[model samples]
Target: MSSPLPLVFDAPKRGLPPRHLADLTLAERTEAVAALGEKPFRAKQLSRHYFARLNVDPAQMTDIPAAARERLATELMPQLLTEVRSVECDDGATRKTLWRAHDGTLLESVLMRYPDRATLCISSQAGCGMACPFCATGQGGLQRNLSTAEIVDQVRSAAAVMRDGVLPGPDGKPAPGRLSNVVFMGMGEPLANYKRVVAAVRRITDPTPSGLGISQRSVTVSTVGLAPAIRKLADEGLQVRLAVSLHTPDDELRDTLVPVNNRWSIDEVLQAAKYYIDRTSRRVSIEYALIRDVNDQPWRADLLAKRLREHLGYLVHVNVIPLNPTPGSKWDASPKDVEREFVRRVNEGGVTCTVRDTRGQEIAAACGQLAAEN
Candidate 1:
């Protein structure tokens, strides 16, 4: 057996912005407003404006009194993300935004509109510390963990965009739609910033006038096999889906592909995932990124299926992602035939497997590609 690798979760040292409405609970927001020499009810009013109406500008907050609106906005709703640029593809159904944080940190979010539902992939941290050699964001290293509000605001902004019919549809015109799904498969390892990410999840799923009112079932949080954190999240009593980025199943290759595997091997990660399933009763998503000449061998697929069947049985599904190659990287997506056979072998091994739909590939929308260029 390999010795457990040391885990060093380091976030860049930086001052986060002052308190924002999304950062606080209703009770906390009430206290914050009271601290600003205002009545407690004012907090509810502000929450309604931000969370329900998705309006942040003081000038647009008609419900609040003219005298108090500016002060309230200034104190509680300070601007968090300034859009640096937006790129679109897939007949404008997919859009990616590069946002500059208040402290000038750069992060990105991708909004992908499908025929049935619109999904937004938002970042929990500016860059990643996972150190996966093939990932663009991981190659950059961690900048900082985004504040709770910073994380929630990305969804709020994307939701507002969908509601207002800003992005074009397959018809090549502005087609109004609703933001239906939110995935944390963006720039960082979400569970690494446990508290803030959990708080953001609450702010996302809680009912309107308190949160965006998106159903908890509509959210998916992905991790790179953080065993202890996965168990911790299961205990949170959330129905949100759990996705483990098991790039490879065998310990030897996984230790190189997902360095955290050295700390908690494949068996440990699978055990943790099973714990999550037992607690949440929701099927876990095993995310496998297939890279040519890397971890895409049919034998590995069979091994993955055998292990998953032993641990999770039918309580798990595999999403095989074709590697979205970064610039100048030797790693690339596997051949179409190889990908199909790999999926076939996994299914033959008694675990269901399917290819994940690759979206926004042209615009660098997949996982860590965006942060790599910026």
Candidate 2:
């Protein structure tokens, strides 16, 4: 009899490599190295190279004996991703890279450098299952959950680029800065790949020599209101910020814009957001994409602020994103007057709000637009 076909919802599982250095804890890394017939202490050296130095080239590993470097490189430091193409903007301050995984699974990540900070936006999944109509990543559907290493590798590469003065800015010089922040806001809904996303966060926030050691406060994980996952992350002892993508105020329009609303209504999602704030004391960010004639209205903004005050009180900030129209999509940003009025009404109801800065539109840097082009 033929084997049953894999479920349509099953995540892509073929391209990932055998468990490597990234999937381990400090102790586990030592154990893994010992298991490979090397001294356990060598694990620290490798970790220092990978995490502290962001160096993956085993040939330059002088600390490890010349004889053993080849074996370790062959066994431990196998290439996880190869850069396919890189699109840059803002005089190279913003860069988006398309990567082909070991088995040819395609994924993308963006790195941006500014005067104050360098931020790397990486994908947690190859594609997303959340069918938010306006989002390119969601419309592509779920391909597979990216491995924890795959997620971490994106940050490592961006950090390396920043360190090496690769990205040029205006006035034709490399911006002297290091990666200061990371956001899992590319190509997929991070929470949908729950376990791996959390693991990636651990690897990101843990102190260097164990991981990249970025501050927990600098990491932001965004979701389109995955209720249970929101509650679970609150209990994870992580200080990372939580961003809820609530495209509309009421259940009526949100149900159509964010289909996940069909399962969990506006009230249920807000309650969960409240739970996060009560438990963590970290401000939750509400993401509202302003689409013309759809959910952008003065009264809807009033209702959004009213409900947020009634539920979450002062523990939330609403980030209004002016819709960046895809090629032929009817949805577009609201006029300046409409947007200002909406913000005024929201502030009148006592909730803080601001418009998000648009970056990389010239190169289709808004979420899944790049993936769609490829």
Each prediction's TM-score against the native? 0.97, 0.95
What is the clash tally of candidate 1?
0
Query: Global lDDT for candidate 2?
Result: 0.86
Which residue pairs come into collision in candidate 2? 12-144
Candidate 2 structure quality by residue, lDDT tens digits, 182-239? 9988978888888888999999999989999999999999998878989999999999
Q: What lDDT is reached at residue 34 by model 2?
A: 90
1-374, model 1: which lDDT tens digit per residue? 56765544757788888889999999999999999898899999999889988888899888788878889999899999999889998888889999999888899999989878899999999888888888888888888999999999999999999989988766768978899999999888999999999999999999988899899999999999999999999999999999999988899888888988878889999999999999999999999999998998988999999999999979999999999888888889999999999999999999999999988878988666765666
Q: What range of 10 consecutive residues in model 1 has the weakest lDDT sum?
A: 1-10
Error of 2 at 230 (Å): 0.7
> Distance (Å) between predicted and true CA of 123, model 2?
0.5
lDDT of each: 0.91, 0.86
